[model samples]
Target: MLKNVVAVVLEEVHPFELGVACEIFGLDRSDDGLPVYDFALASARPGPLRTHAGFSVDVPYGAERIAEADLVIAAATGIQDGFPAPLIEALRAAVERGARVLSICSGTFLLGAAGLLDGRRCTTHWRHSERLAARFPLTTVEPDVLYVDEDPVITAAGTAAGIDACLHLVRKVQGPEVARGIARRMVVAPHRDGGQAQFVARPLPAEDGDSLGGLLEWLRHHLDQELTVDQLAARAHMSPRTFARRFQQETGTTPHRWLTGQRVLLAQRLLEGTGEPVDAVAARCGFGNAATLRHHFGRWLGTTPQAYRRAFGGVGQPAGR
Candidate 1:
């Protein structure tokens, strides 16, 4: 049912967050057998736009484009004269017309300014979470989540989390199959649950690179095999305690939590891409059985494996969150 998407590019916009919308909705991947959404970049004024990086962009469309959009995404733009009035009105109008709205990073502040976030649960960059909550007393701010989907309103934390939000929109609008297809082309994980913590504190040191990257790849490929914390430590050639500590430092989560997320992601793919029964998908994803898969899938995706399959297996089926 989603036919058009309007990305509201503001002055001082973060190119990466805007690029996330373009990557998911604007790209012409129809040649690869994915649905093509009508995506447009619009601004409050139709003219040269400035990026936060000190570059200029020419956007041809204006607020009028938001009128026709099925969805509107507000990309991060550096704070300007306390948010322009036209942008606020345009955003308010879009939501009033029943268009789904999404905000990335500081973009949520724009939503808050428009009074749209008054009674909603939303999230933004972790550093700004406290200020967002303090500024908008009516809004409940969740600091750690990568994104929050309060029905028609979605908000994402930071820049890369924009990808997770956009893919989730695809999953909600089309299905997991379409989302996975797009994600496959982009070479990123398709469905990281929005509820998962952003895991930001343990910043990877610049020189070390990601020590667990290789281990993660191996673990994903061998999901069917039993993987334990101690075994994973041995694979990393470190003591069990040391590996556990480092894993948390690097991934912002314990190994067990990370492994659970990977298993759930695999189960989601299997449910969407294969007609195999739930038990088979479970076994293949290392969930042991359908019941185990159901428990984890329900816990992670807020739906049963069968329901997810039914939704993403084909068109005209209801897409589950």
Candidate 2:
């Protein structure tokens, strides 16, 4: 249903965020049997648009192009405080007509300006989350999540998360086969749940001296094994209390929480790349059983293992492979 797509740009747009939309929707992949969107770039004020990266892009279409789009993406721009009235109206019209709108990073500000985010759950980059919330008091800004999909408006956090939001839209509308095919071509993960946390600007303080990095790597390799705080602490050569404190300081989450997150990520990869049974995938990811895996999957990804595989399983792999 999302056949036509348009990226609405404003001056001083971030090239990478705009490129995210273009890469996912604008590229011609018909040779792969993937849908080729009727994609175009439109500017709120047509002509040469400056990018934050010191370059300018010549967008040929004007705001009117958005009217014909099935999906409208507002690319991140430096100028978010005020949006052109025509652009805002076009966005409102597009949404009113049942077209979905997406915002990458700071682009949520424009949606806020358009009053589209009012009383809706949305998010922007963690760095700008507070400002967005402050400016749009009516909207609920969830700062930690990578993205938020509230029907007509999908807002993604900084940079790469835009890919997650875009692929999610594809998966929801076209099915996982198309999304996975595009993701395979893009060489990126097809689906990172919107609930995943944004990596903080300072993930680990430099003073930590990379002491836990090796341990973390070891834990990843041993995810199938039953791990506990004591074992992890022993592996890190610290008291359990010290390890717990240090882990939180460095990772912004507890050891158990981080391990569970890693396991969930492993389960996701297994589900997408293989035709393994739900129980096998669960065991491989340390969930012990299919029921347990299902519980975690529902809590973390808002979907079941079977459903996820059906949506994103490898193209040629057997259902029971």
Candidate 3:
């Protein structure tokens, strides 16, 4: 249903964020049997637009192109005190006509300026979250999530997270198969829950000899096995309490939370890449049963195992192929 997409470019846009929209929607993947969006780049000012990275891009379209878009994307732009009135009106008009709008990082500000984010839950990069909340007091700003999708609108946290938000829209409209295929071609993860925390409190320092890098890798490979905190503690040669504290300190999440995330990720991959039955995928991912898998998948992905596969299965084939 989301056939046409237009990325609205403004002066001083970040190249990476703009590229995220282009990479996900603008590319022609018809040869892979994926949907090819009628994608275009539109600018309010038109002509050459400067990027934050000391380069400029020639955008050939203008605001008129947005009128036909089923979805509109506002790429991250350099921080400015004001936005163009015509651009803001165009965004408001697009939403008025039932077109979805998405923003990456600071681009959420443009949505705010257009009055689209008013009374809606949204987010931006953590560094700019405070400013965004202060400026748009009517909007509920969630600062620490990868992205926020309040339907009709989606906002991503930072640079890489834009990929997550874009792929999310693809999955929502087209199907999980289309989203996964696009992610595969992009060499990125097919899905990252919008509710996942954006960042850890501290970076894992290289000199910290008490690192859990190897242990984490082992856990990823053995997701089907039962992993208790006590067992993991003994493997790390530390007491249970000590291990728990260390994991929280280093990863900014509890061991259970981290392990559950990994399991869910594995389940997603298996569901998308194979035609295995729900019960088998559940047991393979340590959920033990189809019911248990459904519970966790619903909690994390807002969909059931069967539904996920229905949306994303086929090995390399596109949905309905």
Candidate 4:
């Protein structure tokens, strides 16, 4: 149903954020059996737009194009003094006509300017979250999460989080198979929960020895093993408290939460790509049983394992916040 998409470009747009919109929506992927969107870029005054990266993009469409879109994207432009009035009106009108709008990074500020974020929960990049909240007091700003899908309007944290948000909308409307196919072609993770914290790693001193990269990889391969904080601490040659602190510093999340996320990700791959039974997949991912898998899967993906399997077979909806 989300066939048309328009990414609204403003002065000083971040090319990477704009590219995220283009990569997910503009590119033709019909050869891969994925849907091809009627995607284009629109601006207040269509022409060569300067990017914050010191480059220029020749956007060929104007604000009028937003009216035809089922979804509108506000790519990152940081905090700007003012927005184009006509473009803001178009964004409001598009959403009022039942279309959804997504803002990546500081682009959420544009949505705030248009009054779209009012009375809704939203987020931007953590670096800009405080400013967004202070500037838009009417909206509840969640600073740490990757995104907030208040639908009709979704706000994502910076960078890779945009991919997660867009793919979620794809799975929600076009089914998991389409989302999976597109993600495969993109060579990216197909699903990341919106509630996952934004990663802000702080590496230990070089003398503290190579971070936990190797240990993290080991855990991923041996996810089925019932490991505990104390056991992991022993493996890392540190006290339980020291391990927990270092894990939080390096991963931006507690060890338990990071392990759970990895297991859920593994479960998603098994459910969609393999014919393994629910219990088998659960055990392989450390959930231990179908009920536990269902519980975690439902909490993480907002869909049951059976529903996910069926969705990959061409039905069901998946989303989370």
Candidate 5:
């Protein structure tokens, strides 16, 4: 049923996101017995346009192609000084015709500009999550997730998260089996639990040239232990002050915030995948108690731990994923 896909490329469109659309639908994988999707890139004007990375591309298709598309994708691009009226109309027309729509990264801004996400659940790159929320208060914003699949409209985080949204579309259109096969071929994880917090600005590699990557692996393995800033700094052989400053610079967040996010992520997995008591789950995730977990969950996710589990846990079906 999903035969044709139209991707609208705007000025300063990110090449990586455009490439993601091409890789997922533009390639002919019929030899592998995959359904071939008719994929085309369109622009408001059919001529060479500049990209975000300082290059120009010539797209042959124009806005008219979108009218015939079964699915439409908006690739990430730099924001214009103001929204382009014609482009917004084209997007609105496609969505009005019942075409499934998707947006990658800042592309969500375009959807907002077109008034498509007025009452929809959507996400953009976490860095822009606040902006999206401030600009469109009526739209429910879930910044921590990799993508939000709200049936007809799907939105994803930055760059690589676009792949997750595309594969999600494939899984919905085809099946999980087909999606898993493609993921394996792509050498990416079959699935990522939690959300974009799992990939958000991570702490930089240790300056000691020891590669904190291994240290992080160890920390994950020992999350149940009480972790202090001093202990974490010691692991990297730096003074607590220096470590704290560097951690914020590298991860774009403080050590305390990152730790809290990790613990919450762990608690979510436990709550969903296991029958562990909330108290035990909290302890394992460094919350030390169910009340703590519940408090943080309410603060960050706008729900209690029990409610979150019931909504997204075993035998519990979330209204949307």
Candidate 6:
């Protein structure tokens, strides 16, 4: 049902995001037995629009073009400037008529300006997450996730997350087979759950004379061992209850959840970098058995270990090869 699509291009549109929309919805994939969208670009007043990369693209359709679209994309653009009033109203009207509207990265600001994000949960790139939250106080922002899908108004983070969001929409509407075909053609992942965390750059957990920090590094190196809160509490020289509270305050997550996240992250690396069997990887990560590892990996990543290896780790290659 997601056939007609239009990208609303504003001045200083980010080319990578505009390209993301064009790549997923604009390209013809009918030869691969995939549905081809009738895609075009539109602006508030149809004319030449400059890109952030110091180039120009002539947009031929006006805001009225949005009336015929089943999906409208507010591609990433300059967020500091005011949006055209007519364009904002067109976006609202499209949403009112049951058409889905999506924004990529800083394009979320446009949705915030249009009042489309006032009551919904949304997200943008982590770099802009705080600004988006500060400017749009009504919406709850989940800064770490790749995308937030609140029906009819999805918002994606960076450019990669934008592709994930589009493929998600495709899979939701047209089925997984079609989504996989499109991804194969693009040579990207067939799917990445919208709830997956963005690969945010974080400082290493250094043990610079910090008690909890030292414990974190130790846990990383000893992931093969079964660690409980009581043992960890004793190691830190605190009662279990006090340790739980302090750990939560320090990491923003429960001890168990943090350990699981860490284990899953290690599993991801092993799956990507080595040809170890699932059972071996499970033992190495202290998952006890392959079944337990599969259960937790699927719960955390929305995919099986074998499937992840197929996508990331070279199939059948030896370790360190």
RMSD of each candidate relative to the true structure: 3.3, 3.1, 3.2, 3.5, 6.4, 8.5
The model with the greater TM-score, 4 or 5, is 4
Residues 8-86 of candidate 6: C-alpha lDDT, one tens digit per residue: 9999999999999999988888888888889999999888989999999899999999999999998899887688998
Q: How well is each residue in 222-310 modelled by candidate 5, as lDDT tens digits?
A: 77889999999998899999888767656556777767777876887777667777888989998899888889898766688877666
Q: Number of backbone collisions per candidate, in order?
A: 0, 0, 1, 0, 0, 0
- lDDT for predicted candidate 6 compared with the true structure: 0.86
TM-score of 1: 0.87
- When 1 and 2 are scored with TM-score, the better candidate is 1
TM-score of each: 0.87, 0.85, 0.89, 0.89, 0.64, 0.67
Model 2 stretches with alpha carbons more than 4 Å out: 30-34, 175-189, 199-211, 273-275, 314-321
Tens digit per residue, CA lDDT, model 1, 185-220: 999987887977776556655466646778877998
Judged by whole-model lDDT over C-alpha atoms, candidate 2 comes out at 0.88
Q: Write the residue-wise lDDT of candidate 2 on 1-321 in tens digits.
A: 799999988888999999999999999999999999999999777789889998999999998999999999988888455788889999999999999999999999988998999989999999998998989999999999889999989999999999999999998899777998999999998887687678643476567475588888888898999998998888888999999988877776789888888899899788888878888889999989999998988988788888777776778755542
Better of 2 and 3 by TM-score: 3
The candidate maximizing lDDT is 4
Error of 6 at 25 (Å): 0.7
Better of 1 and 5 by TM-score: 1
Please report, in order, the local distance difference test score of every candidate based on alpha carbons: 0.85, 0.88, 0.88, 0.89, 0.80, 0.86
Q: What is candidate 5's local distance difference test score?
A: 0.80
Pairs clashing within candidate 2: none
Ranking by TM-score: 4, 3, 1, 2, 6, 5
Among all candidates shown, the one with the greatest TM-score: 4
